[model samples]
Target: MAKIKVVLIEDSVVALEILQRLINSSEEVEVVGTALDGASGLQVIEQNQPDVICTDLQMPGMDGLEFTKEVMKRFPRPVLVVSNAVQPSDVDNIYNLMQAGALDFFPKPTSGISTDYERLKSALVTKIKVLASKRVS
Candidate 1:
């Protein structure tokens, strides 16, 4: 099978680096591009036409929600929201993102989140793989 092409939109430098590492390490996923803001995320999306977009909940120049909405409206690709603000049970944002055409979401690692990332890696990879298999059209 082909590797999943992924575009990431995250503002934090540390988190972005970590995510890039994780994504690049996976044989099934590739870091096609990264954007620090939502508008640029859209531009990267248009350019790469990735299989999935992994974006943060909060960002400048726009936010994950608005970017997801616009992306779905125009490009119509699968979106997987990687957010730090969401609690395990509080999946309101996930639903909201899904409503905006995102396929699903994963709780992102925030400050001092090394342990969280190690624990969440398998589930995150699995979800991204599954979502990437679906056709947005």
Candidate 2:
């Protein structure tokens, strides 16, 4: 099976490393590019033209909501919001992100690393695969 190309936009260094490791462990997916902030992420997305984008909602600049909007307006690719900002109050923000064109969401593990690491990996991998399939179609 050809691997799904993924671009990850995350501000936290540790989180980015962890996510890259976890996602790359899946033979069906590959982390093709990464950016520490949404602005840089946007440039990366444009340059790489990834199959899907996995991004965080909170950052120093551009934030995921605005980035998603711009991405949809320009690139129009499948986007998955992977962030720690999915609290109750953030529900509206999540809705806005979806409205801006994000296709899915993944809650950032509160404990830094997930206790059920395999489950998280499986879920993320599954979502990426599903989105990749949709993109292909």
**Clashing pairs for predicted structure model 2, backbone only:** none
For each candidate in turn, the TM-score is 0.89, 0.91
Tens digit per residue, CA lDDT, model 1, 1-137: 88999999999988898788778878888989999999998889889989889999899779999999998888887888888765567568767877888888777765675676655666777888998889895
Clashes of 1: 0
Best by lDDT: 2
lDDT of 2 by residue, 32-126 (tens): 99999988988999899999999999988799999888888888889989887866678898889878888888887545566888888999999
- Which stretch of 10 consecutive residues in model 1 shows the poorest summed lDDT? 113-122
Candidate 1: which pairs clash? none
User: Which portions of model 1 show Cα errors greater than 4 Å?
Assistant: 89-91, 111-118
